[model samples]
Target: MRKFTEEVKPSRAVFVKWPLGHPFGEPFKVRQHNAVIRKAFEALKTIKKPGTIIDLPFRWRRDEDWEDKN
Candidate 1:
């Protein structure tokens, strides 16, 4: 939906390149969920331009454990 977001031009957005439905990461993975949320909040606080989409750094299925990192 990044293309849609670009076309629609929302006020602000946080773009995570995960699966279509799992916008906040896999179910029950609280750490991953919280990380996405925190990024969204961070975008909300720092995004200065309209229609700005901050592409999140998280990957869909990485090898490393997310809980071990910040």
Candidate 2:
């Protein structure tokens, strides 16, 4: 993630804890998407360091709901 961010070099980096492809949230989840966007915008306002990476504290799944048994 940092590698790609460094390569692209946006004004500020807002790192969400979602999956790789779902940057904001899942495809059809409006609430999740809004939350993400709101967080990102909030981060954008108060970020001090230029290239600092802020990881949003969120989880895509509950602890016991799904797991790879293998």
Each model's lDDT comes to 0.81, 0.65
Q: TM-score for every candidate vs. truth?
A: 0.85, 0.69
Compose the digit string of candidate 2's lDDT tens values, residues 1-70: 6578878877787776556787866677666667667767777788887876676666685322112211
Cα lDDT for residue 58, model 2?
A: 61
Extract clashing residue pairs from model 1.
Answer: none
Worst 10-residue lDDT window for candidate 1 reads 61-70
Error of 1 at 59 (Å): 0.6
Runs of candidate 2 with Cα error greater than 4 angstroms are 62-70
RMSD of 2: 7.2
Error of 2 at 1 (Å): 2.4
